[model samples]
Target: MKETDLAVGNTTVGLSRTLVWLMAIISGLVVANNYYNQPLLALIADELHVSESAAGKISVLTQIGYALGLLLIVPLGDKLLRKRLILIDLVLVIAALLWMTFARELWMLYVASLLIGATSVIPQLFVPIAAQLSNDQEKSTNIGLVMAGLLLGILLSRFFGGIVGDWWGWRSMFGIAAGIMVFVWFIIYKMLPEIHPNFKGSYKQLMLSVIELARTQPVLQLASFRGAMAFGSMSAVFTTLVFHMEQPPFQVGASVVGSFGLAGAVGALAAAKVGKLQTAIGTYRTILYSLLVLIGSWGFTYFAGETYWGLIIGIILLDLGVQGSHIINQTDYFTLKTDAVNRLNTVYMVSYFIGGSMGTWLASIAWQYAQWEGVCAVGATFGLLGLVAHLLLSRKIRLAAIKT
Candidate 1:
């Protein structure tokens, strides 16, 4: 099949720039559900009568749910009407958010968080759809544009959640989130076009393909590993930041920690431009330099205890590096199988969020034992592992090319 022949269900559809931006916006809004609870953990704990440690589990469980969704739900994009799948998922997201707002017990909130994360995989669905819609020359640019919105939503979730939670209450933040999701659902229902399903196989076969792809594809494996480490490191910092900021020198509130997300947002916005550069600089090179920046960001974060400037700079670098590497990985992987973009994303993202959940769990443990310094060490270690893995993989690729 040619690059332009994007199989939607029974027909091929071309994506317009306007449509792409709309998808980007929807992705941004929906994915924000997972992160909103991060900054609000402290507030939620106090209100719900849970300890800070127990509250951290909310974020971890949400990410775990996201990983589960990536494995189970995203592959359906290739087997079902894409728009319908997205619309159905959006309704679930709204329902989950509402459930969160009205939860009276800790268990209720935990279940709601899981549902929210699982259903919020709409962004993942949009990504593959966007990739399928674009021609080769425009693919990276289009994905980057959509990714910018997704990244902005991630960074701003904390900002909005913090401010809203501080002013009204944590429950109010969920109420507002549900309202935004409802509006997003309507826009998608009306504007998003349906695509032909490429995979006609049974659901079991579709899942088997996901497992087979992971077992066989070296690029997928390397990309997944690289993404896992980068995201793990990033999650560690954000997950533990509230605890750090609440301590002696800073004595700050969740809103202040939430405001730091703005710096990361700036970095995420730059990723669109960086995506354009991947064609000129090469994908591995982009990933290499991005990982380097990530390492440096953790270095700054290590010393963030003394000054807020350190945390700000660290966040900017962290977001820029992670987003750039992610775009490069997706762009490369998408090219491997046009018919399998959704499955490819499923494998890559499942690995990515698993890493994130692990990082959050690790950071929570680290905070209990070694505090801020331990969190920084955990983050930096993950960054270093990613950088080293990329180097080894690049060398192997070069040697293989020379042999051929």
Candidate 2:
């Protein structure tokens, strides 16, 4: 039997490379909707005649909406047909994008951005699906590849959206995004399998089960906390970066600020093998090392006000650390309970994006108070807290072992 062609249940169907890669591409496109607004915030502010601070709130609101979706909508993956859910989300996001295209007020745009984030969670379903398809040996690698695509979508949104917004306008960017989703929706319909749900319960029970799982699982708690802090560090940097680039020695435009995402993209692509690192060392150890790298990223960012190179270097390390640990945590948490992969992810990701929201919100305040230095400080502090969290988890595990 071919390794990648092993049977799943009573069927001969298995993890085909083409199928996995296709899922990755679709996942990338779906997730890209949430981030297209990041680099365009300044442009939108100017066009709509609002404060940059007010404009930045849209990013925070998007993340919060995403967290809400993760908590509310994603658990349905375990209870409903995933393909149907994905298609429904795609339709909703397209509608939201159209709303964004014609929004004439900040509140209108804010509501549309929130809806876009809520519906753009379709890609997240792919992660659990990828995990379910692979055997234990290949789980991390497959997840890493899908994650690489998702990360690319995130980084590339900034790059592409900045250019689109610069050439056209922020409204035009959303209009274009809506058209792209129409094509993506058809592709998803053709490619996705109609997998049966693992859970058979009322919506209330399914949700209660998620809470029960969270309460019982210490691993889930530790991993979620780590993922939260690591991602918060990255989000703070990315959210405030555009504002920084508009200042002082480097008074570049949206396209240039967005181009810096290429550095983070480089980090994300390089860290795709982090799963192998987790295989070699332990998963938690890899997570620990990643947090250290995350903290170290701040040193470069602190000096970013002086030179563009520092910001570029900082983005590379920051993304490497955050994305690497994220892959590790994501893969490891699924091992806790196979039947509840979607719920497990729902918990992990809800925390992850909440951290992201907090980072964006706090960094806005920091930008006002201490500018780039404060932003760097906030990012580094989250990394440090994650490192400390790892130490706490390690001690807890050791103590539990001793008792046993």
Candidate 3:
């Protein structure tokens, strides 16, 4: 075999069932680092003598850091040994988590949160690695499985953080996260076989290509927009949920609010199955149905303040819609340019998080002005906007194909 073929084949051969599971687990653990502070913001403010608004910036900064990492570090996956990059990032995550555990000042926490967010791009790296190892026929299936793990991590992090922070303090939560990272690092070092770089270019050239790919790829543009809208809407709901629950009808504590994540986890678990459906229905139809589900979620969530059951049902539908559409979007995007999977992912994710940040900001404003009704309206509007964008873009693409 040629050197490149040997490298690819060796990487594939190394991806045993157990190894895939390990990757999934590690991805979940790594990504969870970005979210551990969400449910602990109040606790953090009280303990650190910071304002609630200041404590909230920990989550915001973490997301900004994650976007930065997607732009700067994830693309390097295409140009370097992914195993080494993943391992190095895990070490950085552990160190950041440790710093977070011991942080006394708000500034110390903010800096650590940013570093943790930046290094937490390991899951993003692993998804493309999974794609590279699997053949085309199985690529979506494998990626779906890995992404399910990622979704679970995102949903469960709040639950874990809230419970642990409540029981043993917020610092203990970070200490536990650091311990998990150390274990994950060892597993990755031992189990993940090195995949050689596909792109042999300078760092500047690698960064430039990410811009070129975004500029040139229409499918990527549409997919990124769709993902951004879906995730942004989802973020709006989650970001404001704690405040909603603490109000009159519910009056729940952080731990109880955190348990809501379990409902969302049910939806994330279905992502692998959603991947199978994409083969039968195609991405466009799949996304259409997913958006419909998302709209339905907001409908139920609109009544969440009055009925707890509505929130439970809404959480399930919201997560299912988001995770299903996300899997399809990724599977489709990865097909556009195999060699640029990492960079393509970076573009898609950066847009996705930016949308999330906007959604969170918008939702906060909505809550302040009109409360739950406004938040639900905003969430549903995002879903509708995504559907409309997809319809228009698909029609344009079809017309262009016909003319050509």
Candidate 4:
């Protein structure tokens, strides 16, 4: 099972449609582990007798774990047998999900959340594998397809988490997630083609290369910063949304709160096609507009503190902006150096998740004091800062380009 299953002109290397779809789905489920707890935070806090703000740490811990994994584990993909890495990581994640399901104490649950975030980095492996499987002509489209699946999994995780938690218990959500991961793992083991490593150096050099790429690549920095801010803003909204709804005049259950992710799903679907959109308008403008859209989304969500319509509209726009910018960012960076995608992605994603953790942490604090208004302020501020960051980075890149 080499890359010969799908052929393009002069190249015999592209994934089959079935394999591409499988990669998308498996990657989606794997990434979903980090997010399943978002909608369950209120239930978890109630059961653990902790404050909702304390429970919010699960999201932050998970993102921290993910950032650590991106920094440490993902780079290994460039030096290891990717299929083996994926399976091994999946096994560890399944164990972590089980730990989360059976835990009796808050400390144990938080530990499990961290490990789940660490091991659930299999999707990052899959994305780079998808790029390796693709030929030059189809790379962006294939990457976008797998990315779309990952985004859908992320956007919809809350929806499913809310429903599962409401119907059974918060623990049941973890158990079900573990079960799904097992199913996907078996399928991937049976079907996914094994790709060879690209980097020729030892592990130490591979990590050093990640730093080298980060320093040399301004586009990498821009993409990473922009993604961090967009994801951070998005995180502030979802991390505390369950808390907001559970306590408010709305008083909606987890199920209803999760359903709002449907709006986000719509946005994710639209953003999945952003590869074409970037080509039409150029990456800078696409991302620039996306940042503005994210900033505007906070306005609706602010008023949404009072109305369902505002919440739904805000979610749609929020997701559309965040994911749209993300796809273009990946597309831009992937082209910078295709051979070292694993490391490139490692730098990009490590920064991205760190931003997410900060956003969740800040949103929790805002919820403690300013509540929804404070959360809205945090989200809008991140968006504005992201826009400013992008402008500065873009100008730097253009100036460097002229010199080169």
Root-mean-square deviation per candidate: 2.1, 3.5, 2.4, 3.2
Which residue segments of model 1 deviate by more than 4 Å? 1-5, 8-11, 395-404
Candidate 4 lDDT at 195 equals 65
In model 2, what lDDT does residue 197 have?
74
Model 2 Cα lDDT, one tens digit per residue, 231-318: 8989998898889888888887888888877888999997889988988988768888888888998999896547978888888999
How many backbone collisions does model 2 have?
A: 0
Q: Residue-wise lDDT of candidate 3 within 51-118, one digit each (tens)?
A: 65567678778888888889999999888888888888888989999999998888999999989988
Error of 1 at 172 (Å): 0.6
| Model 4 TM-score (2 dp) | 0.95
Which rank order by TM-score, best down to worst? 1, 2, 4, 3
For model 1 the local lDDT of residue 246 reads: 81
Candidate 2: 10-residue stretch with minimal lDDT? 1-10
Score candidate 1 by TM-score against the native.
0.96
| Model 2 misplaced regions, further than 4 Å | 1-13, 398-404
- On TM-score, the stronger of 1 and 3 is 1
**TM-score-superior candidate, 2 or 3:** 2
Q: Which candidate comes out best when scored by TM-score? A: 1
- Backbone clash count for every predicted candidate, in the order shown: 6, 0, 0, 0
Return the number of clashes found in candidate 1: 6
Quote each prediction's TM-score.
0.96, 0.95, 0.94, 0.95
